[model samples]
Target: MDTLTLQSTIRMNNGVEIPRFGLGTFQSKAGEETYNAVRWALEMGYRHIDTAALYGNEEDVGRAIADSGIPREEIFLVTKVWNDDQGYESTLRALEASLRHLKTDYVDLYLIHWPVKGLRHETWKAMVEIYKQGKARAVGVSNYTIRHLEELLSNTELVPAANQIEFSPFLYRKALLEYCVQHGIVVEAYSPLARAQKLEDPRLTAMAQKYGKTPAQIALRWALQHDLVVIPKSVRKERILENASIFDFELSAEDMAEMDTWNEDYWTISESYNPECSPRWE
Candidate 1:
């Protein structure tokens, strides 16, 4: 297979194209920090920027995009509506706020940030309307488990253009990935580095030594080779550059198979992070 580059794109079900690699602004602060990080990522050749209303960094993200001198069309800007904003009229209002904060007339992609139980399908209905109005080039979801996706597919008219999930070799959701692929939905891997928690695993360490690359790069390459769009988050200049370097290398089938064995369905537990509460996994 040919080596993938930073500029490689995958077309969504809506015919909107998204970059295969992107910089994620999750915990990035909404000021000079977020602004500088985004500016640096764009300067370093990143064409995709993923942020959300929950991140509280939309204003800075928008500022960086405006100052970058790159035309808005050239960048695939993605943002999401938070769980609290997940109802019919509320979602429409949220998208307008996101666009206002993003300082753009339209967003490349808009997502329902999480599957908030009774609100999931209803939120999707509103998103579909937003798509119809061309406010969002494409609409999708994040943190949706397979059961949640099934419920959504059964009710919604338009299939989601993509599904963003927490994916890495350690937390690999193979079955969910397969299901999305079968249904013509692009699977985007957020937190693709596993929050840098398992980067020092013996296997990843060995691969890093053998390949002369960092363990994080090995992890990102694993996600990309699985045909998943990867949005690895980092605010540091060097780490951002390191994450972007994975495109030059391709993992072999044998190596990928070995990486598959690393899966433990690991979940990052935090006092504030509740997947069941927010995403409602089955």
Candidate 2:
């Protein structure tokens, strides 16, 4: 297997380099908590950070980045437009707000937080314009299924550079992963640790013992070995550091296939987020 490290990156369709592992800031509060987490991650050599406007932590994330003394170009930053902010003009304004909150001129990648029912196409058009204006190095969507991807591909000119989704050994959406791969879209795993849902499963625990690593490491290694980007979120310093320690070991192919059998199509996000069953357009 190829060696992996903190600096390992995968090139997107737009030719932008994105780290294979990143710090995810979901549900992280918008002040010192988030600021400290991001700061520590950066100080610990993390080069990529993912946040979304809906997380309400962009300001803190920006503060952490600014305080880290890391050069802006050295970090790959990402943020998304929220559902209500999913129209052409609105998305343009939303990006401006995100940029201001992030205290940056542009984001490495800007994504649609969800494929909001009717406005997705228009929102995507705005995203393309944002890309053309150099405000977003690359554009993408989150929680998008193959059906949603098809819609975007059939209507938009630029293919999404990434798709952020709930993924783990247990909730693995293999077909979606395959679709994204076939379309040259990088699949980023959120809830990559199953939000701790299966972290203590006997299978994971057994694997952990075999590898002499924590169950969390085993879970993360599973994602990394599949060549998918994994961002396991945590605000605690030790946990933050622990999340990045998956690069040192390799999971065997047999183990990989065994982990693959754990999938149960579980949905970790709130019920309202089901792409096929979103609430009525607002």
Candidate 3:
């Protein structure tokens, strides 16, 4: 078994260390299913896990973390406040709820799940407060477009430690990537495999053939090459292990150029992010 090496870790703005590769528990079912997924992921040597309140699987994730017997400090647990929970008071309560559900006193990273209409600034304020109070080690956002990030910078004191977005070769975000690099925000690729659509992509396959690795691994390597934290998810044990096997080979610059050119108007998620929202999270 190839252990995920520490040579790949990325240091965030807040001095919080994050593993470049991790398991993403988005939309994983609740109860036993999520618990099993988290346990399996940890058993397979995943040290970071990303989840959100809207997914409703925090308790299951927490249970697995607890049972894994991995000390709380060893795991990089991340959760977010949902759209409805965007106000200062609501975000505070929401963080508490996520903590209780995850069975932890604090999470490594807490994020705003989305930038809904009208409430992102206030939510950011609340997040800063939480960070200031030492409730969360770092604060960040997900699905925040560049416009949203610019507005956040204009309004808030804390620069986000990360921005987990849907990034793959097919949806390459060159400008946003540069912006994040300039701003000190680590760009995290949530759908690095493009929801598994890129598994059979010819460009990726050709590179995989050349490198003798899977297309999934090629996709991850591409993201990592750009210094993005890539979270490729899987419930199957073989896949869980396979996703972490990108450390052995490096994608060549010519192949990286070809893979990078694969981007042509593709995005997996809908529901455009508007930073305005009604004050409540349910």
Candidate 4:
């Protein structure tokens, strides 16, 4: 298989280069916890960092980025707007708020956190406007299903450049991934290590043993081998460094195939698209 690096990038539908490995700020609460994790990740060579308005850590993330001294252009900054901010006006205001909190004038990628029922079109319109205004280099969505993708494709002139979803070996989205490949949208795995749940999986553990790496590394390698972007979060400095070290080793095709056959039930997080989820569009 081809190799990957912290410097490697996946092109978006809009033709922007996004780092293959990103630092996830999900659940990274505000204050020193998030500020420290982001600082450590950047110090350890992570150029891509993902955050959302709902994470409530944008200010902390902004602090880390400001202090890291890494050139803003060298790092790929991506953040999303939550469902509550799903209207054209709300999205516009939210983007400005995110920018203020992140302490950056432009984000590398701005995404619609989820596809809401009545206001997704309006939300998307605002996102396209953000992109045109140079506030966001590219715009996309998260937790969007194929059905949701089709809606945007058929109804709008602007196409999403990427889709952020909970993807890992336990939740291999083969069908949606195939569709994305055919449609020019890049699929980014948010909970790439299943939020570190696969730290004890037999298949992952065995592969880690064979490679003398951590189970997390094996899982991340599985995603990288498929050419998908993987954002794994960790507050521990060592773990942050370990996750970025995935580029040094390659998982064999045989092992990759075996891991693929492990199972296909990995969406532990309930998304807005879940029919069971009562609409939370505010």
TM-score ranking, best first: 2, 1, 4, 3
Whose lDDT is higher: candidate 1's or candidate 4's?
Answer: 1
How many clashes does the backbone of model 3 have?
Answer: 12
Question: lDDT, candidate 2, residue 159?
Answer: 97
Name model 1 segments beyond 4 Å from true: 269-282
How far does residue 79 in candidate 2 sit from its true spot (Å)? 0.2
Tens-place lDDT per residue, model 4, 4-74, is 67879987877899999999988877999999999998888899999999999999998999999998898
Query: lDDT per residue, candidate 3, 1-282, as tens digits?
Result: 233462357899988899888888876888887888789888877889999999899999999999999988989999999888888999999999999999999999999987766788888999999999888999999877788899889987789999988889998889988999999999999888888975887777888898999989888888888888988877777887888888888777888887888897577765343222223211
How do the residues 214-233 of candidate 2 rate in per-residue lDDT, one tens digit apiece? 99999999998888998989
In model 2, where do residues sit more than 4 Å from their true spots?
A: 276-282
lDDT of 1 by residue, 67-117 (tens): 999999999999999989989999999999999999999999999998886
lDDT of 4 at 145: 80
Each candidate structure's TM-score, on Cα atoms with residue i matched to residue i, is 0.96, 0.97, 0.93, 0.95
What do the candidate models score in CA lDDT, each in turn?
Answer: 0.90, 0.92, 0.85, 0.88
Candidate 3 TM-score, true structure as reference:
0.93
* Cα-based lDDT at residue 179, candidate 1: 91
